[model samples]
Target: MGVRLRTAMLAAALLVAGFALRAPFDQLRRYLIARCNDPVRLPRLAEESRVRFQPGARDCAARVAEMLPAALARIEQEQGRPFANPPTVAVYVSYEDYARAGGLGDASVAAVARSGYVLLSPTLCGDESERLAGVLAHELSHSHIFGWRRSWFAARPPSWFTEGLAVMVSGGGGAEGVDEAMAVRAMARGWAITIEDTGLWRDFGAIGFAAEPPPEIFGGDRFAGRQRLAYREAQMFVAWLRRIDPQGFARLLNRVENNESFKDSFVKIYGAGSSRRWSEFLAGVSR
Candidate 1:
């Protein structure tokens, strides 16, 4: 009985250690994949430009290398700060490889931002050069946010702000299929993305969200069309906020990047809760 107990305890200890060490292990795995899988590093375009691509995808890699400087500069200009560190971009010719290398989000997503690197999908490398730039800029925006904030801060913002701000910065990359007119029509029909200044713990961990609309209504699957509409509405709302108060928008971005309370900073900057601001946005859309 004593030997059995010791064996069980040892097993449990090893299991716990694995769980504790998984993040760093996974991070290392991703870095290796980024470095090894994409063997061809393109010509240097800027101090921060380190783009890697597979041989089959050299043409796309060249495009990325060409556009990266302007894209990074544009994102920095819009976000009001420089990237804390240069992002290493890995462009893949296969969706399977991209997924294996820590790409999150649905397959339709063009690019995904990791902590210090980016994974670009094959579709974005095609003839859609315009879309390629937008998607690149969008992911870079996420990279900028990751630079300054804690890991948990990534999930702290309401999805609206996170996706919407990226959409706005990229000039409609994520919400490409839907436009302002279509989003307004959906809002008029009672389908709209909810705007909330989420608390630090709202969507973190296993805690259930306070009874809110369904996820599909918020950011749904690609086939349902709800996701695109939600993204578009979110972008429009963010744009409205900036247009109504440019200085206030800048201050809000500063506060958010500095790890301030999103809810408090928003109210302080705009003089009202998100609900009120949302209503004003709706009114403006109606007009």
Candidate 2:
């Protein structure tokens, strides 16, 4: 009888130990999933980090899935080949969260390819739903064009070209016009930022070449002044390219994606060095 009692107690103790070990793991798994789906926590992880989903994120995901095929079709029409992979998009509703994630709502951001996602805020949704679709279409074009490459490449294309192409592809004509008018006025006032100075968009913190101290424009109420200028000038340059040779612009973009040297591609399409053509183009616009 004592032996039977000992056997029963040993079995009970083992069962209890097994559950004790599994309990923590079960709790940890739940915690991990909760964090993954937490809209607020995920955005705070890192700058330019991709959060796969947020609470109430399914709506934006569904909207993107619905709109992306058509946008891809347009891109294929221009490039003559399908994109390498479909992009991953993340949508957030909080402006604070959006800024924390290193994003601006005035434009959608496309990280070069590895797990590319879109960050959307309520401000971008606005009254019309189609506007959101347009924004997604624009950012997705960047994803498609860049093809999942990170910013580590030494010979990457410039911000002006990438951003200009995105604006051109997303059909952002009105914004381009508004920026051009503003730029013309700013230039007249002797306040125009130089292109060399504007190249700051390539870096994370310092997005322009001005002497002003780095501003916390991402989290604050205002837009980053230099970033705003870069986007505007990029749009105008692309719009100019479209006006000059629509088909050539399309071919040039395709060539860019194919890893063609920028100078070679420019000479082939525009019949001269890009630097020369860009200077002439800027001068014409300024006049």
Candidate 3:
């Protein structure tokens, strides 16, 4: 019995050590830094950009912060515009603790842009550096939209265009965890939501969204399915748009920044029946 107990204890000790080793390196480094530094506020800076936070599950701060400059460069390169001042990236430790950190609305949000700060939660996004970087870039896109808009009164573009652009630019777009074939198959079944404004429709048939969104897209029996399909459609559509119109995409983005409505900007490039063109492209590719 004594020998068995010793063996069990040794195994448990090793297991604990293994778990500790699996902890993210940045989290550990920040912990050590916080021990000697101030815990009330910890700031990590890269290329004069900043990530402000207190210690918690938010250890990916330094890596994400470092990614900002390069991400911004890519975003600016793609959009044909730049910002005079980049928004500060703020890292909140976790989703559940977001309110404790002074966030509003649902903590379930992965990230958000508000005022002078772009808030990111590692807990919501997992501690993976790449995922966090994507989240940062996406939120930065939101900031870029506002910054380049250059007008406080300009109505923002629809969520689909804005969020889709963010996803593609961050390299996180493309089928999201859903397979392209599956999406195409869903389209073939004719159960796909129609491409319309960002608000409506619950299905897609390889073609893009279509008109007259339901008064409410939520609360239906198919709400979850619809919402999921909506996001996939948005990302895929933006990617398709960029793919087809490359240089013209820059013009479209500029028009949006110049406060042109998404409808006008798209029509200006693809001409009338652009939505129909999306369907024709889908038909050619899916078959």
Candidate topping TM-score:
1
| Whole-model lDDT, model 3 | 0.60
Q: lDDT per residue, candidate 1, 1-287, as tens digits?
A: 69999999999999999997886676566566656544334433343358877658777887888888888898899989999888877777877777655423245556778757777888887645557887888888878876667656343666677677888998887677678887777777667666677733322211122232345544545343555666778788888889989999998887777777778888998999987999888887788
Of candidates 3 and 2, the better by TM-score: 3
Tell me the whole-model lDDT of each prediction, alpha carbons only. Answer: 0.72, 0.55, 0.60
- lDDT winner, 1 or 3: 1
Q: Cα RMSD for candidate 2?
A: 15.7
Q: What TM-score fits each model?
A: 0.74, 0.60, 0.66
lDDT of 3 by residue, 1-287 (tens): 69999999999999998876654554445344433433235455443446676475345666666677898898787667786466777676655444333233346456666555676755534643445766677778777876766665555566667766776787763224444565565556553445443221111112234442343533342433454455555567778888887988888888888877767667778875446666775686568
Tell me the number of clashing residue pairs for each predicted model. 0, 2, 12
Which residue segments of model 3 deviate by more than 4 Å?
Answer: 1-49, 94-104, 124-130, 173-175, 191-194, 197-229
lDDT of 1 at 213: 30
Point out where model 1 deviates above 4 Å. Answer: 1-49, 103-106, 127-130, 151-155, 199-221
